[model samples]
Target: MTQPSPLSDRRVVLAVAVLCCFLWGSAVPALKIGYGVFGIVPSDTATLLLFAGVRFSLAGALLLGYALATGKPVGLDRRTLGRVSLLGLVSTAGQYLFYYVGLAHSTGVKTSITTSSSTFFSAILAHWLYTNDKLTGRRLVGCLLGFAGVVAVNLSGAGLDLAFSVLGEGFILIAALLFSLGGIYGKRVSGQLDVMVMTGWQLGLGGLMLAVAGLATGGHLGGFGWEGVLLLAYLAALSSAAFALWALLLKHNPVGSVAIFNCLIPVFGVSLSGLVLGESFLEWKNLVALALVSVGIWLATARKDSVVGRPSP
Candidate 1:
């Protein structure tokens, strides 16, 4: 097979990655609506877990249905099942469970800013784990650029207090760690299974786990108003659709390098939140923070052989 030129491959991956960011970013504002509209009046943790449960369960079921109708062979072998299970737990279940809860405690902008730190966190963990994909000099420069945007969005203006919300930040940090774990496990199990089938298994199992957690926490399930239903559909469709695309990209492209696209989440998420949720957009500190995150993303993922900062060259 004469491989297609690298430029074409990069273009495809970049397009998919940006789409994923857009979907996820768009979902954040919808999520705020979900929290407000849902009738299950649980505390923050249970409420967030409930949202994760509903979203993942809907996504998982839809994927499974698609796989079955298409004859995609969705079940995993024993060993692969274990690996996928772990990946589901770390990447999807753990990460978003924490993320939703954190969102309740912080503003959309703050949560988005905190999430950008995932690249920094992943780089450190990927390095410590002796992961083969070491950060290149250009990648570092890009990540630092991205991190600068993070700082500008988080703490670079007069109204922005320097006081760190450890609780909010800590949840996102954990989400980042879980994301790294998923990527690490992906390195091991990726080639062994069909990507779509693997995604079905991961989403299905992760959805189950989140549902169980929601049950354990006594998540309330009521209030089927139009707004609630709309938010639910939004979370399930937008977030999960994008995630499926993301999983496909990870399957076909460079894993660690692809992870850098996560930095775009804050950029998209914050902007969408401002427009849709009436979140503020004019803060000078936020501009600086955004710039820092953009820089950090650049430092975190820039490469020498590419015109754009994508996983492929």
Candidate 2:
């Protein structure tokens, strides 16, 4: 008898997926602190890219090192090399480029809502790409619930605005679209390459592109005091762990199943940002957002049978 892989279990998938989202959510505050510690102004797009590049570069190095230490093949053939690099550029470099710049031009509330659209994008893209991963009523309802939670979490203060700009919400939407496309592309590539090695290369290569572009655009990064060093290290650590887990999940599960958890990122991001930055996060909206997202996750992943991502062909 063949034993089912642990990742095929819904409970394990939920735990790992949530953990990955939590780590990513914490990056919100850590990034703010990082900017202050390193003296990066909001308008300094060059420095922002440089900082992101360094963090992702270090993260890639960490994963690659671990892969090497564990005796996994990190070397890529020519065919796979190009594919991985393109994935890196689209998913990492291109996505973050728009994200950082757009964030500067948009409000945080708007940004959160805009980026949450990636979950929907992933679901829709999955519907077209995978025969078995059709967008059903349950999936649609679950996505709507999750998106409502995202909106609820960001309903603090002035609430959402009608104003939109190309550089602001527009760029973020592009990032979200790229993220969805990248996840699908990555799933296809992961079948041809080791997940760890592919992720490491994409991060490393994409980060290198960002670093070079930042430098060409007059970006400078320094002032690595012990605090700064530790902060950067923490950011890198989180990226490496979170991205690797996410890629692993995508490899084994449907994009909609795993990608739906993205809504929780804002929930955790808002809560942790408030806690760390001394802002109020215990408001009714936050609680409501959490409840909505929880139910959404349950609805998205709830299945009658033990079968998980794969269905009968």
- lDDT of all the models against the reference? 0.67, 0.90
Q: C-alpha displacement of 309 in model 2, angstroms?
A: 6.3
- Each prediction's TM-score versus the true structure: 0.82, 0.96
lDDT of 2 by residue, 118-180 (tens): 999999988887766777889889999999999999895765796999999999999999999
Give the winner by lDDT: 2
Superposition TM-score, candidate 1 onto the true structure: 0.82
For residues 1-313, write the lDDT of model 1, one tens digit per residue.
4564342266676778888888987876776677677754334577568667778877777777777899888776788888888888887888878776665566545665667667656665555554345666766677767655655554534545434565666776677677766765664465587665666667767877887887798776676888777777777777557767776665554454566777777667767888998888677755665566555544544443332223223
Q: Give the Å error, residue 240, model 1.
A: 2.4
Worst 10 residues of 2 by lDDT: 304-313
Per-candidate clashes come to 37, 0
Tell me model 2's lDDT, rounded to 2 decimals: 0.90
Error of 2 at 245 (Å): 0.4
